[model samples]
Target: MPRHDHASLFIPPALTRRRLLGGALAAAAVGATPGASVFAQAAYPTRPVSLLVPFPPGSATDAIARALAPQVSKALGQQLVVENRPGAAGTMATGIVAQSKTPDGYQIAIAPATVFKVPHMQKVPYEPLKDLTYIMGFSGYTFALVVPESSPWKTFQEFIAYAKANPGKINVGTSGAASTGHAATMRLAQRTGADLNHIPFKGGSEVLQAFIGGHINAVLDGGWAQVEKQGKGRVLLAFTAKRMPRLPDVPTAIELGIQHVARSPIGLVGPKGMDPAVVKTIHDAFKGALSDPTYRRYLETYDLEDAYLSGADWYALAQKMWVDERKILEELDMLPK
Candidate 1:
């Protein structure tokens, strides 16, 4: 059966009566757990919870996870230790959490859109719908199309014109192949008929290093903050729905006649089948951590907003993304043969 021709291939048509009853019975079984086990569920994270960051320490995702860990730990009466496990554009750690036999709330990872979209593009170790438990969404990155300060193209239009005229001469760098930055760059190329050569690195720091060393013409990433701060690059366009407040002078993709916005939000998730009680405990703690002044200040520093969503809502969005990403990848000819 073709996966993209119909949504039914991905979404179940309807819940059968037997399946509904089975769900109810499963809930009853959870309710039927011994009082001691139930109490233990309420007292989740008696030990430190290890929060996995699927990127390097200097990356934006790692910074966000570290910023919230201490406050979430305070709320839960347990420490939240952040561990970096960077590889495959964040799939390495995400796959670890997904393939783990343990569903205890003690181990969770920060999930990005790649968690949903990557599985559609290639064979991954885990399934997005069945292998991971969506926890709570907290924040998003501010992505931009940045070029070196010495580049002659001052505006996005000039850059696009140059890319179109020169074809593959425009070497663009991103965190990794099939990353949100790569996807957005490809979308822009498709929209503007520009032939861009995409160079993928393991993380944003590497991409920045390469861009600064004149190895690439530009990079699409959140690390634009560091580049712009140091006056090493000029931000020509923001891959967002609206003009970023901090970069009000910079036009958005939409304003530049490209009808695309990079909606790459970040969230938390654990292995599937986590106890509902424990899920709630972690969710509530992180939800409260959203208000932490330090985390909020981090958001302000990076031109991001507090994009919070409940677990159920995040799961629903992932379902939509599963279908949407297949279409996007198919259009880009990125799906594995």
Candidate 2:
């Protein structure tokens, strides 16, 4: 009986090489999906991470990424690459990142408030409000109205007066037709009888370029402040209720008796199903970056606020805004339904 018991100690003859292969195949099948790897998130950022900017290089959005990238990299132990995939008024790149299946915290994007309305406006790839996971809030655009330095209009009043006297002669450029800038511009025209000829461009950079080249009389964009700061364009009025800090001398639309604003809140967004822990890690890194002196300096330099919010808070705000913006989009005749 003891000799017979040696069978238990020896390898079972039934466990042939083919059986071993079958066992391995079974294990691999189980490991195919991310859920199968319980510790996948705990070991994140094994390689360089991308911070996708939905605007061209030298843009304010691009500036945000570049300013915070080094600090975020130091916090995460990996390089946070600022990659620009500019097009479609900052939606093309956003859609690319939102639809990304890589949930390992390697791909994320800076989503602007325009995303809220863009989807309802027309058919797009991703539903920004639901499709992407909001990570944290960042600074918003300080939209303003500016004219070339050599333009005849010296003040906001003069511009409006001229517009009233000359109906469609005032040509204005914006990021796009349905862009926040364009919408704000149109709202201004509707309110003040500007009758501005709105010229839509692909991005704010183009709007600014056109304005600088004297292709347009005025440009309604966030980049207007930079042009004013650079002494290229003269800011006539801020679209917001308050004057932009960088252009403190400039009058607000409210001060000029125009009740309007064009501030577009922006935030970080990743593909759906991102691990909570990974999101928290990214949020904390960005929070730290927002607080960094250099980054803050950049924000101030660009006339931007460090509007950082916790991941939970940011998501809540996005959801609430989604509901609010839907109504506005509908009123603007930009709803799918």
Candidate 3:
């Protein structure tokens, strides 16, 4: 028998290299196939979902979130947790939501209308319309220009006249710069040529305190339904298009001949690129909760009015409002310097 060379006994060099290359390509194709990850992404909210609030525990946003959490959980069959991360005119929570992972549907936020105002007043990391998906609108509070019961200005017109005559001397307290209260006050001033001073506070409670202590001439605030009824303060005017039923005698801004209306509405949102299915599920659950007797009673107790909108409708409204607000702020020169 002739001695066989090892190289000759083996497969050809080109064939060996080709076989290895083909095996590696086949393994890569198997690993890269879109199956498990795609399926996992499709079945979202496999665990608890977080609903972030930019206000403190007892705030209106917090109240609504907590009130609806159970209903939402029941509908979704997942734990819906309320997480408070309040600060920076709601920027703290908004920023967290903005920077969170997108399209995962794990993190959602209850954002105030102030989220739009914040970017105009200060440096914010996210664009209000572009960075988040507006899931749906739930509720809104009626705003009022309130003063201590014994204060001199008895009517909205009287207050406007006083501010017009006093120019920058009349001071008012608000939740913060570019807050709904501040914007409403500014719009009032712009429309009437009143030069009232603005004092920004951290929250509504502080705004209320400032007015009660006589630290400020007036407070521009929402949720005045409870405060007005408490008798600590009197509403001069409802800063809305229509007068609140509870404050029937109190004229609305529009009724007072002012072309401005302000309401601090809140809606659920998630990071941009949220899955349409997840968005629909969240919207439907919250919309149902909004109609639930328990939640409706909570709204009545708080004197809040229901303002519902679908995800697409809410998103469109947000976009349009930002444009309208920017124009108003620009006219008043209230846009950040």
Candidate 4:
């Protein structure tokens, strides 16, 4: 208002699930007659719900979805089938959900922050705000810049200074060119007048591999802390609001005079015209899932932040983010190609 809907406030009894849901469908269909998408909410989720996770299985978003699946299934009284459609920086899966012909709330997706930014980068099959039913946001990732322990730079300051001096000589690795990590790094370069080159990989695991192998000078990723703790690398800076307990010795980018923090917010969504009653049911189920101790602990273990926002709130935020990130895309020459 992200996953566990703004502290579960009472939505006034007048806004009952059925009434609110039916009313939304009626408004969206723009006809006096009831449509399939409108009336389907009355007895929603009768069968298995398909959850399309854009990244590969075992990825961060995939882990979160699996963690939430059982809890949501118990609450909804139905099985949640998580389908992995990893490609095109998560846009492939997004397009699948967008093109779903089912009027029922069976098709849904959990995507990264890039869902809101990718359209500005190039042509995509669906529009973010207009094509999807905005569901609750789950959690946000904790990103960091890490280098192999053998690198010449010891701290974030030294790395930045070196990059500023060397310009495009240094290479930074991320998931993809227009992904959140890449955008944040581009923004940082704009703010700092640095010209470090960025190398895009298919996913974080690939980027981590490249970073550890010295194929890239440094890597900006969400999984760096885990690798750093394993003695494989060292995090020069955390892109979080506060210092993580496990890495107290490392400072945040904000502390180093950088104002932007790049965190990938993960969440669920559905095809356009999903019944509001169905939306409420799914939202409540996911909220129940997020409240589970195991899920919360899993998130904490990875230093990810709880960014729960309600359906209405998340929808509003999506619209605003779409508008807000245009400037960043333009600044990075990422508005197209």
TM-score of every prediction relative to native: 0.85, 0.83, 0.80, 0.82
The parts of candidate 1 lying over 4 Å away from their true place are 1-42
Native-referenced Cα lDDT, model 3:
0.71
List, residue by residue over 56-82, the lDDT tens digit for candidate 2. Answer: 887777777898999999999999998
Error of 1 at 230 (Å): 3.1
Whole-model lDDT values for every prediction: 0.77, 0.73, 0.71, 0.74
lDDT for model 2: 0.73
lDDT of model 4 at residue 308?
A: 85
Candidate 3 ranges with C-alpha deviation above 4 Å: 1-42, 160-169, 191-195
Q: How many residue pairs clash in each candidate?
A: 0, 0, 0, 8
lDDT of 1 at 249: 98
Full-model lDDT, candidate 1: 0.77
Q: Which lDDT tens digits does candidate 1 get at residues 1-337? A: 1221111112134645565455434433322111111112335678999998888887777777889988899998999999998878767777888887877788988887877778777788777677777777777778899999999999999999999899889999988888888888888898999999999988777888899999999999866687777889999999898888778899999987887677777788887666656776788788888888888877776666678887767766777777787787888778888
Per residue, candidate 3 scores C-alpha lDDT tens digits across 145-260 of: 88888878888878778888887888888777778888888877777888988898776666776776788988887745555677878788878777777778988888767777
lDDT of 4 by residue, 86-116 (tens): 7777666777876776647788888677887
Candidate 4 minimal-lDDT segment of 10 residues: 1-10
